[model samples]
Target: MENFTPSISVSSQVTHSLLARLLALAYVDQEVDLREVELIYGIALERGVSKETLESIMLRPHSVSTILPSTPHERVSHLYDLARLILADGIIKEEERAMLRRSVLLYEFTEENADGIVDFLLEQAQAGVAPAQVIQVVQESI
Candidate 1:
């Protein structure tokens, strides 16, 4: 059988869920940095999430249940971006780590491998690795 890849549609639910998870992570440290907010807003805007919806979700991200991406690539992509957000404010607090675990569970990533995945992403991000490379390595690892 020929390998087939179905394109993942960027729906408003996906965008909102992605941002909500990121926003929840951002708030984990108890200090939402402007840079982090900017990144989330930028992504939300690009993904066609309404400003109003983004604001609402941003205000109460904990209330939003993240809609996990269905594909491997989508999962890795979201995890990569979450890693970026973790490093955005120049701090990765313990609180953020806890939040990432919740996100991993929410995304249905293997519980045992969740820490390893976050650690990998943090190492790559700290080394200034390209996003594409990070995703590629993550995909390979998975």
Candidate 2:
């Protein structure tokens, strides 16, 4: 079975749950795979979000959170953190790379800003930053 550990930090926030599910789906079948279905179960349990609630969100064709950013800065921040994760392992697969590129474009991050965030994540990962630190960065950045 896949390691579908729902991040313990994400609590009953619908938006957070939705994003976690979407990311988990994106990670499906990758070299570093995530179990999309199991992740759904895990997040619902961790966050106390009902399974039905997550099921509804999962039915959407596109991720709803993409357009729900409250501000441009907020969107950019999410993009930065996502890009950081996508590139953290140093060898971004083609699919992951394309996703990051499009996300940066959609979030309107400048080339310089994107590069800076990517480099920062690479450095941090190389230095063996803890998962808690990485999660903190994502929460703060967004």
- Candidate with maximal TM-score: 1
Scored by lDDT, model 2 comes in at 0.53
* Model 2 C-alpha lDDT per residue in residues 1-142, reported as the tens digit of each score: 8898674332234355345534643564354433334544553555466677667666663544434355554454444445445544445566665566556655566776775655565556446565456656766766
Candidate 2 minimal-lDDT segment of 10 residues = 8-17
* Displacement of the residue 99 alpha carbon in candidate 1, Å: 1.0
Stretches of candidate 2 off by over 4 Å are 1-32, 36-50, 63-65, 71-77, 80-91, 122-142
Best-matching candidate per lDDT: 1
- Structural similarity to truth (TM-score) of each candidate: 0.78, 0.47
Per-model CA lDDT versus the true structure: 0.77, 0.53
Tell me how candidate 1 scores on lDDT.
Answer: 0.77
Clash pairs, candidate 1, are: none
